[model samples]
Target: MTEDSASMAITLSEQDKTTLRIAAYGSVTLLSAAGAAGGSPHKIATTGSIALGSATGLVGHVLAEYPKSKELNGRSVADIADRVLPALTAAMSLLKEQAPEEAENFRSTVITAIESATHHGQPGPVVADMIRKITKALDAA
Candidate 1:
């Protein structure tokens, strides 16, 4: 039992290190994606926030795809849902201040719908809406 416990600790530590490394690389990808999304037409501040949010969303998507991380490895679906929902919420908050009011409202509704569906354990609607919004947003950029 002692040996097994030590091995698990080592594995967890390695997983944490890997997650951090991936997260750092992911952050760079996010920054690039956001900058590409925020072309020259937007207000400088608005573009910056959207760029940040876009990067964050990209990072969240990537992290969520990973099967395990020290923080998320054994968490329940609800716990995962809890973490997933907030990224979108935070993105919406940043976007609301920067995006057109109507566009911001639509994105917020889309995120809320996704979160509600995830909470209910039927996430198809939420995912579909999210994908739709992402496609639209990307195309508009």
Candidate 2:
């Protein structure tokens, strides 16, 4: 994060931070699950997560602090999506309201993560669909 952006006086509660983390990391998890059929789930998660770790600005600061794994929902793609997709939209809305400047940063961070996750190989229809849904949710805000 640049010194200026890092010092931006944005306010966010713990709940809001958790929401952003879940939305971003859970996005990678969802992609991992979707690509499990004939893809490297580990690689999908690793790259996406790494991309998130590379985020800049307030989004970067929030994302750098990992969420409690146990707090993340879902054992399946559908279940996870139910929790994460809304979180994705909610996260966007929260950022737009609480930190309007960081809103685009958050969106770009998630998309970069998604692209990193899928760029490992030819993403199948399932992965592609997941990406579309994620993008939709992010835009829903």
Candidate 3:
């Protein structure tokens, strides 16, 4: 993380840090799927690269604050989906405007990721609720 990034994350609580991590992970996953969704590679690459850069920065911020640990990381992922739902909604809205087909692709990719995350154990009501919320957001977008 850059000095600025590290500084910005210093004041965040653990929950906030977890939310940032989840949002960044979601952004990267969606953008990667978008890049592969058959389009002008140049356009997708341009947009994906820019968005990935920002998302990676946030990921770095979270990582700097909390080093990777399976226990903490697992719990964080389990707790993060609902908290980051709004961020995901906003991202879906933007992608829908900029690249409608890719938006759908991104939404599916996110759902898959969420499902995979839940496979290890049951996600709490929050994760289940966020999945529905994300589905609605993506459909509306």
- Model 2, 126: alpha-carbon shift in Å? 0.6
Per-model TM against the reference: 0.25, 0.93, 0.39
lDDT agreement with native, every candidate: 0.34, 0.89, 0.44
Please give, for residues 9-127, the per-residue lDDT of candidate 1 as tens digits. Answer: 32223444343223222222222232333342123223323333432232323223333445432234344334433434444443343433323433443333223323433324434
Show the colliding residue pairs in model 1: none
lDDT for each residue of candidate 3 in 1-141, tens digit (9 for 90 to 100): 664454444354565545434443543333333333333324433443344343223333443342233322323433434434555665566545544444454565555544543444444454455456556655664
Instruction: Give, for candidate 3, the lowest lDDT window spanning 10 residues.
Output: 66-75
Model 3 clashing residue pairs (backbone)? none
Where model 1 places Cα greater than 4 Å from the true spot, the runs are: 1-74, 101-141
Q: Top model by lDDT, which number?
A: 2
User: Whose TM-score is greatest here?
Assistant: 2
Q: Which TM-score value belongs to model 1?
A: 0.25
- The regions of model 2 sitting more than 4 angstroms off are 1-7
